[model samples]
Target: MVSQLDNPNLNLIPKPSHTVKGLIHIFTTAHRNFFTDVMAQALRIAGQGTPVLVVQFLKGGIRQGYKNPTQLSQKLDWIRCDLPRCIDTPHLDDSETASLRDLWEYTQKVVTEDRYSLVVLDELSLAINFGLIPEIEVLEFLAKRPPHIDVIFTGSETPKSILDMADQITEIRRSHTP
Candidate 1:
């Protein structure tokens, strides 16, 4: 056999470059009102200097709205629907519907523009289930989001499509009655 140190084809293969991509995390429970852990995690991440956005989809009563996002920290933003009461059902007045649509559109815009390193969609499942937001649109948004941005979905009755896309799923359950 001849000396094999003269192969030129090996150099044609391109080397893989290192790229960091974030993941989808889903937190679900059988009942509502249990996202303290997710909130804490968002706060911790924001405290570390990574930009974070928290959007409460079905929650209201404070009139926070998309234009009036509350800055929790230097790198954290919190927003809610601009309604006089929290949404627990599918029925919505014209103004309420408009508010939800505005928030949803704003969220998609910011995420697509790569504004945050992490995003928390609080009560997203309820909004989707109640027909306030379209699931297909959400899927498209997730697929097109910046590669380095992590997303967290927290709510009860999370749809199968969203759960299927999650890299991590945490289901919360109570051990005792309150």
Candidate 2:
């Protein structure tokens, strides 16, 4: 498969090498380590002294799947919105509310402020699908978002508008081979 980074259109915040820096979409129906894979790349970038922020909107109870090295303290920021399960929390209503707020606030800050080098919005597609966040709003945000900051969106379903606007897209699928 061709890497998204290989896409010529992805030159938004062109590196010295000329690469895009906004809206990376990774979708998958397979139960795989897509988040882990992306986080690993974020870690690598952070290692180089670039700021990285990762926010996971799902409340799966799994905390940051990666270790936070002290050396990268100021370089990396990771957060997850995994709400606990309980009868009172039917369908994660609380989580949905909390994440919607968090994503809105943080995402706005990231795009408008240009504080981080890379911002990974894990499971953001889920938020969009759940109607917690509007796709058009995000698209508008991206259009106005600083060109120097790179952002990523990961989940199973991707809207056509997003696909058309993105600089790169990587789709993950489960292997059926026995």
Tell me, by lDDT, which candidate is best: 1
lDDT of each: 0.92, 0.66
**RMSD in angstroms, all models?**
7.2, 10.6
Alpha-carbon runs more than 4 Å astray in model 1: 1-16
lDDT of 1 by residue, 11-64 (tens): 998887855888999998887767788889999999999999999998899989
lDDT of 2 by residue, 22-93 (tens): 555454444536777888888998988988888766644543222321234568787655344211222446
lDDT value, residue 159 of candidate 2: 74
Q: Each model's TM-score? A: 0.88, 0.71
